[model samples]
Target chain A: MTPASSAKAPFQNKLLPLMLLLPQLLITLVFFYWPSVQAVQQSLYIEDPFGLSSEFAGLANFTALFKDARYVDAFLRSLFFSAAVAGISLSLSLLLAVCADRVVRGATAYKTLLLLPYAIAPALAGITWMFVVHPSIGIVGRAFIAMGIEWNYLLNGNQAMGLVIFAAAWKQISYNFIFFLAGLQSIPQSLMEAAAIDGAGPAKRFRDIVFPLLSPTAFFLLVVNIVYAFFETFGVIHAVTSGGPSKSTEILVYKVYSDGVVGLDIGGSAAQSVILMVIVIALTFVQFRYVERKVHY
Target chain B: MRSFIAALSLGTVLSVSALAAPVEIQWWHAMTGANNDRVNQIVEAFNASQADYKVVATFKSTDYTELMNQTIAAYRAGTAPHITQIFEVGTATMMSAKGAVKPVFELMAEAGEKFDPKSFLPAITGYYSTADGKMLSMPFNSSTAIFYYNKDVFAKAGLDPEKAPKTWPEAFDAAKKIRASGHPCGLTTAWVTWTQMENFSAWHNIPYGTKSNGFGGFDTEFKFNNPTVIKHFETLNDLQKDGTFKYGGRTTQPEGLFVSGECAMIATSSGFLGNLMRNAKFNFATAMLPYYPDVAGAPQNSIIGGATLWVMGGKKADEYKGVAKFFTHLSKLDVQVTNHQQTGFLPVTIAAYEETKKSGFYEKNPGRETPILQLQNKAPTENSMGVRFGNLPKIRDLIMDEVEAAFAGKISVKQAMDNAVANGNEELRRFERTAKN
Candidate 1:
């Protein structure tokens, strides 16, 4: 059946269209936009957790955040963390997806096994990694000790950051793998065959033909992975490192939770959230303007 | 007409029974595992004892910070429980939310329950009390930082198995000997801020902050970067450099090091006794927190850690009555003694302490009494009462971060303490602006 077209047969009653959209419109307004607006408004005031009293602080909260060295450090740390997570997750997933796509035997079993990690919760994933690499009890941790490496992520800032990055990237790889496989499969096999008959090696054909065709998926996954690293990986950081080892792993979202929810600094936390929102918006704008131009799609 | 009258009478009877149903008071807490089971037992006992009220306790989270966050969000949304178990660090935050909490002392008195502030341990209750001696929250599972050492390890190192170090220099020397004896981790600690900074300051009778350690007012400033604290951190830094001390993860993660027989000694919360009793395969004992013997009035008294039960405002008068009844039940000698014995929490009431002593419970369990004796050894001075300030959790986080930096050899002890004080003061200032009336 042909999909219904709004252009060919417009709604006879204008009010019916609005009525049809009312539920989603109301939900979006109530849940998403309203909270965003409230965060912006709350950023302008200092209030207790109980809402017993409030004082208009204007831009004082934002000013304090900028002046604070830790907040600035967290912003820069978030950028570095997001970039590392996206880069590692995408590249590793791409590699795995390429290998899995080339397999003709037991491909379903291979794909299912690779996708298992995506089913684990972020916090559980962090906890599992913690167990595997714990300095005292973990397998890898014991191996490191056996080798006399003196591995202790508990006190080492760089080690803690690396641990969190590994956990975060590991969790996102399955998601990227699914998308990359789909993108790779969607590419015309005829083109690769043509390039192969021209005596091009497998690596050359993949580099020249397969890689270019997969740019759109790569671009999309980049945006998604960056966002995931920014906002969703706090659970991993919280569970594994707790932004510890001298706050080396403290990113923007975790800092917001630490200061706002855990510390009960409503105004300061709200201000941080507002700043993060603007950063994400600006990043998205830049990606669309500059990065998307390079994608074939 | 006669059948209709009988039906109306039956309806009246059912409605009356429904109206007379017991008042149900909700209690939200962070206790988990065996401790959570103990909470359920207490609530069940209270529920069975009376028909007027039924208390329902819910375990909200595994950690104090998450529980506090949930409670705060619930309070803001007007769905707060009638009672909440808040950790000791949140004492100042709960106290500052003036109208949001109903002081336990007031609740008890208003409900005409027998609650004598003098009956409670001053050291434990003082942290949650106003300057005027008004107790703000009901002391629940209180604990203090103490020294835990492996007796087996001590014997292996050719040290006195029964004796624990009472001074910093002695502890350091023992740690060196332990390391020389082939111990991988000579010594470690958990709750670094609590055991090292807050309790350390109190145990030495040094000011952690101005204004009676911030128990007096909101204008208090952090004074923990003093020379004594700096010296203590410097000693720790030196030990870390010599492989005598291992830096553990923040907040009780190092307890594993000691449990696994990797660390010979640990300075951590007394409440960790339950876990040690359950898991440790070696002989372990407890001692008072070590102090610098040269300092005057050193080792005065260690302050309470753990949590307290606070009554939330906006609850009904009947619910408040139920809360008062529950608190009274909890303060009974038998209940307190059982809790203190079972969970390693301090007995809050003097009667409970005396009863436990008379029953020879301390004699049966050798190290269980150390926390009580340490808390009762001397009257808490103004500097030793407790550290109380708004935004205390955040301040502790900052301190922990800076201290970790120092321990990691990235910065000097002096620099770490200085940065902690500076950053902590900024947090305190922001808290004052928002929380102060």
Candidate 2:
């Protein structure tokens, strides 16, 4: 939260900067803050789906939300989902970035190929993975069955969770890789060579010099990936499992849409959205508060 | 000089017609594939028959639950189409939204359009009508649960291909035999809650709820966790133990398994006939949905599926007239018969059924009469009319979840039924609160 140290020679006129930042400020207020305020206000009322009429319920919506065990289950499921997505995507992307950073031949092609999945839509990514592992016709699913192993995601909750996690992380790996690769390449070459000259092995140098310098980018990516898993993975879940087979894959965000929009429970859906907004805000706050302290930058 | 003179006259005629364009009525529907083409064809027919009004059909159907949700959203935004098709599961939601919809009975009466409530087959219209007998929506495409058995598979399994199972126990026995014959799948069902729970209760002449399955009021409770339903689930769960039955997920997902010549038998929407005719490689025939022969007054009429065209509120008066006229045109015997014969949707009217029968359509197309026969096998009792519950989509998910848990051996069939009732009742309670004031 500290102001950038490099801004010592900042602009003298506050009015110029304020004018420059006005558009973004307005956009955030209208797009983010307005709907957020409405969600909070709507959550306080018992309302029908069509927004035709409403009654003041005064926290009844929140009470009803927590009284249902499924909402709590969805919360825990979301936590596990977000943590796994961020962890797996981060480590895999870091490994790939390191390998690509060391590439001397056609580095651009390697990087381009690695980044291809990032551009694909999340729903399309879910569908592509779905067909590849579909129990009946999918290639991977057929192999599982051929090997005498059970492989139906539509019936099995654990398999459905695993498939969605892999698909969601698979799409996110490339986004993380670009940042990790940039972090690696930005490290001065002299720092690594100096460590080697001091009898440090490559692994030792990476552990000592490269990782610490890359911590800032890694920290930022972790926060972004968690947010991505929380709010933006609705398309993937919708096209794939649809919170199916007994609400096994019902994450908190998907529940909001399923409840409010599909199920026509407007008050409950709004209440869920309010809770999600609080969780995300608290999550980002924690990431900046604690995680930022360790970043070398 | 002759070509220029002819072109000038053509331009003048086109300009004159363009100045007097018809008033457009927007219709949003979810019909897809072959059904989508049929919907457009019907709209074109309506438009061709009128000079002042043109019905424009837009395929705005989203996911199963989304169409109702989208209609509500559009209503709030004041951009709802003049008419939108809603699934039967959402009939309760639409019925309670008095401010959001214009009832078909009122629309027809106000527009002076010739609409007869008695003209529609009661089994289909009963699902969309009020307790005092007012039709809420136009019954466009209606379907009921029907059983399909692969004749080739039945013969291969050493069963009499001509004699399909007429009871639940017999159907299960036949399914197991198909599995014993090394078929990949034996039996499967689509829309499990619809086929097994809603229609199953109706077909058994059992009360699925207290207030005539919510048709009486919005405060109906769930009563499906009885011994009868539990026994049915037990049979299904046992079938899954040896792969005699495959849980084909939800809503037409089983259609692929059945049509791919894999599954021997399936209980799915009669609307699936179109798909079976197109994609089924094996010989298959339709039968009345199997019922428990032990239950007294069993084999009651099956409830309808498919969707109805609802007129949204807030359109101009002239557009309302167009929607009314369109509904009248759509309910014509010929149009209804074409829809029934082509798409396998049940003809909504008694006239259409009699006409189709009189034309020897059933003789030409064997097995096409199974759905109608099942729907009219007996006088529909209170329980057999239809079931409605608010937030039925959510309740269906809960039921599917528990049913899956039972099928996956995470719980007993008794426990699954218990949880389904408990959870489903909770949704009904939430809806009760929403519906009252």
Interface RMSD of each: 1.1, 1.4
Error of 1 at A65 (Å): 1.8
TM-score for each prediction? Answer: 0.95, 0.93
| Residue B219 lDDT, candidate 1, scale 0-100 | 94
> Against the true structure, whose lDDT is highest?
1
- Candidate 2 per-residue lDDT, tens place, B327-378, comes to 8898888888898877768888999999999999999988788999999988
* Each prediction's number of clashing residue pairs: 0, 1
**Which digits, one per residue and each the tens of the lDDT, describe model 1 over residues B47-126?**
99999999999989988888888888899899999999999889888988988999998999999999888888989767
For model 1, how does the per-residue alpha-carbon lDDT over A1-297 read when each residue is reduced to its tens digit?
A: 245676666877879999999999999999989999999999999998888999999999999999988899999999999999999999999999999999999999999999999999999999999999998899999899799887889889898899999999999999999999999999898988898899999999889988888887888789889999999998899899999988999999999989997788888899999998997897789778766576664
Model 1 regions more than 4 Å off: A1-7, A10-23, A283-294, B1-14, B17-19
lDDT of 1 at B23: 92
Q: What digit string (tens of lDDT, one per residue) describes model 2 on residues A1-297?
A: 237844773776779899999999999999999999988998898877776678999999999889889899999999999998899999999999999999999999999999999999999999999989988778999999999989888889999999899999999999999999999999999998999999999899989999999988988898899999999899899888998777888999999987887677777889999998988898789888867576655
Q: Which residue pairs collide, candidate 1?
A: none
